[model samples]
Target: MKTEDLITRLAAEAPATAPISGGRVVMAGLLAGLPALALLLGLLGVRPDFMAAMAVPVTTLKMVLPAAIALLAGGAALRLMRPEGRVGLAGPALAGLALVALALVVWRLVALSAPQIPVALMGRTAPQCLFLLLGLATGPFLAVFWGLRAGASTRPALTGGLAGLAAGGAAATLYALHCPEDDPLFFVFWYGGAILLSGLAGMVAGARGLRW
Candidate 1:
């Protein structure tokens, strides 16, 4: 067949409706998750010193770190939705930030009095951090997965996992406002672990659900 004739024939058969864009899908997921997060935050209440804490670098970093992770992961997820897309630097970027956080914690702990080490590592809310983060992330996870369902991701598992990271990271950012645990150690262990767990869940769900 002539190339021009074939092209014309294929174009005529194309579906009239345009597929939803990745940005729109992710935006919808984010919107879907917002109400749930806001409601949860309302119930839990923001820290009394939230405004004051914002001036502190340590306090600010807690939210900054997760926000960065969410941006990177969400960007990656959007890219991965395209069949030819690659993860690029998102994974490494997350690892680097995590390492920086860990190093800071270790340095701070080393300089602390031996007795302070325990207290710093085990902040008052350490136990609650894990559950709270995961709980808050639940809505986003479901929302993002629903968004992923509309995408034709070649790397479904990876895309889902990134989406999970985005969701968890976002939840953590908001949770940081209410979380009184300012110690880096607490963040590195609990906050980081929770985000990882969310990614793992996404991986499993994507592997099972993102198939064509």
Candidate 2:
């Protein structure tokens, strides 16, 4: 085919432009996940002493940290939708959060006796917390994935990982409402593990699902 003819055909077959931006996709993911998350919350029920629990500074951190991560990581994920997008502040911000979490975990570890260390790490619901957070994050993660399909991300794995981080963070925020375990040892370890796993899952999904 002639060069001009080939160009014309390619342009005609090109995909439609995305309807929204990456940041919006992150928000939409949350919105899409809300109903299902709410239903799950209803089944689990919020902690009875929520009001009292919130009074504790550590308990408040449990909610705030995850929510902050969702917002920040979601922003980065959305930007990655564009071919020209870079990591920008997302890397540093995430590292900062990690350091903060690690410090908190260390502090908690110091406060606990040797016997308590094992018990603290293995909080009352060790298994439950990990699975519940991962399950809860799935809806939002999938939603974000669907939204990102409208985009043309060059770095699918990174984009998906960020989206997963956002989804997991949001789920953790909600889970904190029901989880009475306020200790950093438990929340940081279990919640972080769940979010990391979510990121890994996202990486795999992006590798397979985002291909044109």
Candidate 3:
């Protein structure tokens, strides 16, 4: 075939543009995940003391930190969906979160006795926190993976991992309502662990699912 004829045929067959942006996809995933998360919360029931506890800075921060992480990670994931986009401020955001957690720990520790330290660090739900967060995060993670699947991400695994981080962070925000453990140390550890685990899972999923 002549070169001109071949070009015309290829152009005719080219796909049309997508209807949505990466941000919209991420938002869809988040929205889709919300119902399941709400059900989980309803089933688990919010802490009886949550309303009164929210008055405390530490308790409030428990909700705020994960929400902040979700926002940052969502922004990163959206950027990562583009073939050439980078992770921009997400790294610094996470680092800042860690520093804040560290400061909270230091502040709390200065006021507590040695005997109370262990009890504070290992709240009654310490053993269950990671597992609960992971379970809560699963639906959101899957939804995020679905949302990102059609993206032309150069680093699929990394993008997926960031999506997982976003999902886990959202889950943690929901979980905080039900979690009575107000210790910063516990939040920093178990909640962080759960988010990390979800990120790893996303990495693996992205490697497999996001492959073009």
Q: Highest lDDT among the candidates is held by which one? A: 2
What are the runs in model 1 whose C-alpha is more than 4 Å off? 1-14
TM-score of 2: 0.91
Give every collision pair in model 3.
none
Residues 139-160, candidate 1: write the lDDT tens digits.
Answer: 8788778877877789888888
Best by TM-score: 2
Question: What are the runs in model 3 whose C-alpha is more than 4 Å off?
Answer: 1-9, 109-111
lDDT of 2: 0.86
lDDT of 3 by residue, 64-173 (tens): 98889888987898887778789987889888997897798888789889999898988999877888788888877887788777777888888888888888898899
Model 2: residues with Cα > 4 Å off, grouped in runs: 11-19
The lDDT of model 1 is: 0.84
| Candidate 2: pairs in clash | none
**What is residue 115's positional error in candidate 3, in angstroms?**
2.9
- Deviation in angstroms for 63 in model 1? 0.5
CA-lDDT, candidates in order: 0.84, 0.86, 0.84
Ranking by lDDT: 2, 1, 3
**Which window of ten consecutive residues has the lowest lDDT sum in model 1?**
18-27
Which of the two candidates, 1 or 2, achieves a greater lDDT against the reference? Answer: 2
